[model samples]
Target: MDFLKLPKRTSGNRTYGLTSIADFGTPIGRLTNILDDYSHIIDIAKIGIGSAYITPNIKKKVDLYKEYNIKPYCGGTLFEKCFYQKKIPEYLTYLKTLGIDWLEVSNGTLDIPLKDRLNVIEHAKEEFHVIAEVGSKDCNLEMDITKWKEEMQIFLEAGCEYVITEGRDSGTSGIYQSNGQVKSELIEELVKGMDVKKIIFEAPTSKHQMFFINQVGPNVNLGNVKLDDVLVLEAQRNGLRSETFYLEDADANYVNQTPTH
Candidate 1:
């Protein structure tokens, strides 16, 4: 494979080209099967939404992900639910009991004030690696571009390990329009003068994945990916898929070349 030149990927405990899968109560056996084959390409596993709260054998599931060197965390919606119920302390205890060391702090479905959100992130950093999410899940709720950048910067400064742009599992909110088309201008503006590595764009579909790969290069972090799409996404990242086969760095010498035979 080394003899074939393709887009290079950041390998071995990758800081970029991260693919985070959303697990919606996947049975342990199936999860194990997936990890057995694809753990190397997966960086994180999110117990999607509030399912982590009631998933059977939740602790074992979390431990299994850790065994494969994957950081497993409950979705931020669970955290927001706890916040709404004034059980933030209890939620942290629950996560610790499950042996999960990563946390997602998001306000997608809630209207948590900036001050409170910052305080939550600052305090959570003492116990867990925090990933803060920006943008609303509600498609009709428009967030100003300036506010998006400001909040992202503020979250990073407040000790967030990474900032996530809210493209829900549906791939039709936050940075994307209602029709699932990416707001390209907004994305370009948001990344200007910012460390792209610190931001994980939620790309849950082929179109979104291809766009991010082409626009942000192969090493961009992607989130909210379905369990089955991990291998294909990795292929696209390395220019092995038709959508990204023409990536500029993908051994262009093979293109438009005359055949000696």
Candidate 2:
């Protein structure tokens, strides 16, 4: 089983540079099956949106993900909704009840004051592993790369373990154009003067995943990966897929075969 050695992937428990998967209402059995099949490559299992509420045995599912060393937590939209509904405290209590220790704090849909966002980061860090997200989900509410860089810096300083670049689950908006194409110039500029490793890109589609992996290498932190795509993503990460063929290491033992007259 160990004969075909592949590139080393970052450990699931590694503090940064993670592969975060979105659990979009998958039944517990399927969720556990995915984890059982590809736990080694999955770092975080995000309970996307408020959909966790409808999931049966959600707590057990969270615990199962944890048992595999995958940090499971609700999405930032769920937090945003709770905050606007005056249920931040209740949400925190509910998360605790689920035995989840990771939290995603973001204001993609609503406008949250910088001071307050930082305050939440400060507060959440005390009880949870906070991953703060930057950028607005609305395509019209775009920020330039410079401002995105500055905001990510502030969130990191505010004690967030990692910051997510908002590319909506559809692979549109935020760091990407409405057409699902990445702003290459923007991405290059943002990583130039920043700790690129600390940024997790939300690349939900295979195209988006391949683009980021090609641009930033295999260990580049990626998010919003679907449950079924974990192994496929891992294959791409290790140059085992056609899209990543350029990443494959050359055969060291090969000799040039030339037909001589």
Candidate 3:
């Protein structure tokens, strides 16, 4: 497939430019179909927020992602549930059973102490690739960026491979305002001393994703993407979409070429 040349982007299985999507309630067959053509742009498949419990052929779905080089993992809500139920050990074992190699740990819905959160990260790292998420899911809650940065560092040191800034599936909580706008000030402060590549900004919408891609360049790692939006997001990343088409300076001949039937 000879296509027009485009800007260089990071490869999968490595790091940076990562695109993680949520598989919330999608059946295994439909999930396979989604990944069949677009898995090349997807880095991870997250069974969003406890939806793993009800997914049909869960193990089969996990294996299918692995078949296509896409890592499969659970959302942080499953971890929060196990923590509140005092079944973390059981949860880990269950993930093992499901063949999940990645895990997301967050206290978005529950109030967890820093020490305990770090401990959770420390332990989960032993058996899985951990992604530590920091921020509250409640739109009414406020957080200082300085504190957010410090906590992210702590989680990183605790064995987390990547840190996710909480931007809930609705794109209205955490790093975003209740109205779904990205808080540029907070983002500016959060990246002051942090490795932007090691951070996965939870950008669930095109606007939010475009903001990060533009502000941080095309290699910014993004998460919580919906299954239907993967290729569209890739288009934005590669400047193939209208929002970012200016980044590409196509040859006039190619741009003006007539179509052949």
**lDDT of each structure?**
0.87, 0.81, 0.84
**Winner of 1 and 2 under lDDT:** 1
For residues 71-182, write the lDDT of model 3, one tens digit per residue: 9999899899999999998999999998897888899999988888788777778889998999999998999988899999988878889999999999988999999988
- What TM-score does candidate 3 get on C-alpha atoms? 0.92
Q: Which stretches of candidate 2 lie over 4 Å from their true place?
A: 1-6, 249-261
TM-score of each: 0.94, 0.90, 0.92
Candidate 3: the clashing residue pairs are none
- Model 2, 184-218: lDDT tens digits are 88888776767767789999988899887777766
Please report how far candidate 3 places residue 15 from its true position, in Å.
1.1
**What stretches of model 1 exceed 4 Å from their correct place?**
248-261
Candidate 2 pairs with clashing backbones: none
